[model samples]
Target: MSEVPPRAATAAALLIDALRRAGVRYLFANFGSDHPAIIEALAADRERGLQAPAVVLCPHEYVALSAAHGYAAVTGEPQAVLVHTDVGTANLGGAVHNAARARVPVFVFAGLTPFTLEGELPGGRNTHINHLQDTADQHALVRQYVKWSYDIRTGRNVPQLVGRALQLATSAPAGPVYLTGAREVLAEEVPVPEVAADRWGPVARVPAPEAVVDELIADLQAARAPLVVTSYLGRTQSSVDKLVAVAERLGVPVVEYNAEVLSFPHDHALHLGDDPHPFVAAADVVLALDTDVPWIAASAQPPAGAKVYVVNEDPLQESIPLWYLPADHHVRADSGLVLDQILDRLPAGEDPRAARRAAEAAAAGRRIRAEHERAAAADMAAGRLTPATVARVIAGLVDEETIVLNEAISVAPEVWKHLPRTLPGTLYGNRGTSLGWSGGGALGIKLAAPDSTVVAIVGDGTFYFSVPSATYWIAQRYGLPVLTVVLDNGGWNATKRNLRRQYDGGAADRTDRYWVNLQQSADFPGIAAAAGQARGTTVTRFEDLEDALRAGLDDVAAGVPAVVSVRLDPISHQAEDPV
Candidate 1:
């Protein structure tokens, strides 16, 4: 970019340059026809020594996006997605929702069939392009999930289009953006723009209103005690440093706000995992930061009549949900900027919030201790092996480096405590409520980090959602080994709990009802075998369940895929709720 005159490049190559200039480092995608031009362009870049974002081929559109989601969580930078033109966009939309829910920034590009242009060319190797693929507009498929989307109409428009999308997607409350490349557009000759890095270039304004911040800050200052809850401050390691600085400077107790990845390391003195109800009640002021602020017990909501301040990049637009409840006073601004401003302005002479932070930290320690005690007591008293017992038994068997992917949300406490995640990289779970995702995700994690063991724990309610086909994909594509724990609860345990909580316990008998229960349960182990998992076992008690899991882990360590099904109480599994 040394002020050279414009040079001719294919539209696809120009788009790649724009992305490369935009600081995108990874692209997760599956092969597709309409995208051969882009792939060819990527190939040319490799030939010429223009570095391409490492492309990770995914088996399914969902897996590609999920991997990107995890990558964004790890890197804290925008990750890109390239999919086929028609069916690809349609398949990738669900993955976009996962990114949006996690607030992960993803730039998605889908290739379009250029049938009209093909008609202009002599009979081509890829003939009857219209008959083979779709030329009709497909960007409309994901407009709702993405923040911005448009088809590049001309080759000359590549730089502006890519730059604008990247800038917007990486700004405050980052999420997904969709872009399209017509086959003809990919073929057109255009000059690539001068390379310029754009991330953090535009000032990140708290797009949320300002008055709400003032009101909330005043309310917080007036409170005798306050708690701040968020899933995390930063998505990457660099973000963690800034987050730690803010938390330490403020002397505020930071609670993990319904997070998958550690927002704050669990062992930190001021860090408490989600149980904000008591803390909120005890506090005179409450600050809910980037959190999904809601009680699992829908019956009991966030405490009423407390001085509440809700701050976010986009403050609860129109009574939006943080976790469970709507925000009170909303301030739209960057968390890092706000933390800096508040720290710069506040008193440093005395630590008034120390006692409160200490109290919550103490409570967290007690909660952890109690959970351990409960696990021990259950192990001692369990007559027949159950999910809880099996989990405890397995904990005694696995190594320290083993990684557990938990999809058992209903029995999360069971799985979370079964094998403690004392060290980093020991456990992973979905932050938001997306089931069936873990079945495929665990395989991806294992493949990415193959030196370690990967175990996926999923509830029966979620198992069928991620069919055995997903597992087979893991075996066929990555040759990855994973121990999948199918928690065979009778029904959608979480849904039944909802029904019980609703209608004043009117549907008690629905537990046995056709629609509410797993009356037609599938042969889970058989399904696993069909999906290419050898030595899949169905466990009915702790006698064989833990043993089976240990054997599976060892087999996996020796390069074999395995599955173990454990019977779990659909109701009253671990604790109906963690709180």
Candidate 2:
């Protein structure tokens, strides 16, 4: 008979080994009383020279999940995150929501309170805190946000449970998955199964059907004006190139709306500005690729006689409860695969009107860009650092290798106007509208793209929400340096605008309206200095913005984290109007 192979002495050891073998490079962790066994197992593995997924200690659960989210966004590989019991899992809800919306793969693991009070297992309850920490349904904390959730039932089920979670996370319509590790289960000894590393890798991406491709091509061929609108198309460099090729070849105008990733070359002749409403209203054939809200229905919609095609791996966007975008043709397949197939099948030569369309689009794009620049200049000359000017100066400073993470909602459209991202993986934003994602997301991007400069452009309101002290300490502790630029508008400007638009001259119009003002701004630079790992600077003058930004960028390039807080003007009533 064949001799039995060795097995991991503890369930936690087997779980860690399984994750490492599954291509996870890092495990962001926030420990608690329930994590002792897993922590010990990790230390033991390190001592045994079996490290692959290095453990990164995070100060908070939100940071851990956000870091994991950012890492997955850049690497295109699912990463692991370990959190404490109920409270830690509760803190992860927002970040998990962001990951779910972004469709980034994250494997989240949380420890459960001990199952026994009499020490039936190696790590069973020894203190009263265990009983208090135990919840009736801990997994429910993140159940709705994740693609799948499980509580490990037995020590022997660790390998299968973990493997299943990873598989679900990396599968089509990828998102986060959660698994709770019972303290007793983690400590119990069981024979580890010999699960193959590739046993549960991402399922193969199937191309779109030939009939759908042909119909799409036929529509493109027949249409006088074609437009492509996307939000999260540029997951890979090849996808970006392929989409660009298809648009240029077909003479289609591409608009990226609320783009979380750089979907197209902004400088391309056929590339339209960020807003899709105008183009969507004009195009005869509208191809919406991977965009959730192609156009706000109340404010804008496709022309009455236009045909719309919506393509995505998950056509319905199941994560979102109330998505009501209209589409005539909903092709459910991998976006990159569909684009590649379209490129392969498109007619050899350009249409008769291709040149004219291209020229007209190019001219319009130039006009739009110029208008934005003029508006920015006007705003700056008025003695305030406009969002556009700040974005433009930063755009001038950054190269193709820089990665920009933006969560400044009010000024994001303005920033995109100045910073024409031409490279894939060079831009990311909050698709889920989470306030504190950028600060932690920037750190994750820096970890994944250590050679590239990572910058987090956030608002003053967002800066406060980001848990600045914890984020900075994590950066310093892990040696991940990212330039953090705070667009200080003195308050929740977006909220203020909404109130004015919704209430008009009602109670909200009063200057003393409750919870609207954040008039007393904190010294952000001083806050950074207190962290001991980051340096900070505050720029109040428009003329000083450039120098301050350059200095902060220099500091980041020198392997130190830096913050540049630029005082922005109040939201202009005419902010949304064209120049």
Give the best candidate by TM-score: 2
Error of 2 at 250 (Å): 0.7
How does model 2 score by TM-score? 0.95
- Give the per-residue lDDT digits (tens) of candidate 1, residues 34-112: 6766788788777766666767676567767766665555455677778877787777645676677667677888877
Clashing pairs in 2: none
lDDT of each: 0.65, 0.83
Instruction: TM-score for candidate 1, please give it.
Output: 0.80
Q: What is the lDDT of residue 40 in candidate 1?
A: 80
Instruction: Give each model a TM-score.
Output: 0.80, 0.95
Instruction: For candidate 2, give the lDDT of residue 344.
Output: 83
Instruction: Tell me model 2's lDDT, rounded to 2 decimals.
Output: 0.83
| Candidate 2 deviant stretches above 4 angstroms | 1-5, 380-383, 510-514, 570-579
